[model samples]
Target: GVASVAISKCCQVSDVFTELCIASRTKSKCDALAAKLAPTTRTKITTAQVDADDVQQLCDLINSYKPDLVMNIALPY
Candidate 1:
């Protein structure tokens, strides 16, 4: 799961990613994913309702979160 991935990354880099923002059209799904990831990982995960197809919205979220990197895992369709 996401927590495992974060843990793996932390092990590799010797630094835990503290803040993460999950942007998805469905807030519930994002929330669920974050919840699942929270217990096992050291990162602070957050969710935002956003339409990936909307460039402006994505931009806004990116600006608000200001993540070190944006991981685009949205569906193609």
Candidate 2:
């Protein structure tokens, strides 16, 4: 999973941040990845369910997390 790879990279270079919020349309998938990352990474990892197409949901998620940066990875379909 790309998410796994991305989270692994974050663990590899975890000096810049103390936490990561993993959100996706599929909450189970996000949670699974977050679980995988949590034990291995020094940085704290959290999971949430979010549908990026929903503006309010996305905004609320961003507001809730207040992340310093967000990486939106999507396929060009």
Candidate 3:
């Protein structure tokens, strides 16, 4: 995924992102992406399985993470 690769590149610049969570509809894909990005990133990588189509689950995820900022990479088309 472009976002994962791009994020890995961003990490190369500096330790910008301290806690980076990659949540996707496909949990394994998220894990795989993190694994690929791990070696090149200083950011702490975490993975979560999320179905964006689920409103309740999405709310739960946000609360669980309690992120200072949220970047919605999966933009609605």
Which one wins by lDDT: 1 or 2?
2
lDDT of 1 by residue, 1-77 (tens): 46435434643442456677776777897788778767766777778899878899989988888878776653456
Q: Rank the candidates by TM-score, best first.
A: 2, 3, 1
Using all chains and alpha carbons, the TM-scores for the candidates as numbered come to 0.74, 0.88, 0.82
Tens digit per residue, CA lDDT, model 3, 1-77: 57676667656764567778888888998898888878876778888998888999889999999987677777666
At residue 66, give the lDDT of candidate 3.
93
- Stronger candidate by lDDT (2 vs 3): 2
Off by over 4 Å in 2: none
For residues 1-77, what per-residue lDDT tens digits would candidate 2 score against the true structure? 67678777987777875788888999898888877777776888888999888999999999999999998876655
TM-score of 2: 0.88
Judged by whole-model lDDT over C-alpha atoms, candidate 1 comes out at: 0.70
Between which residue pairs do clashes occur in model 3? Answer: none
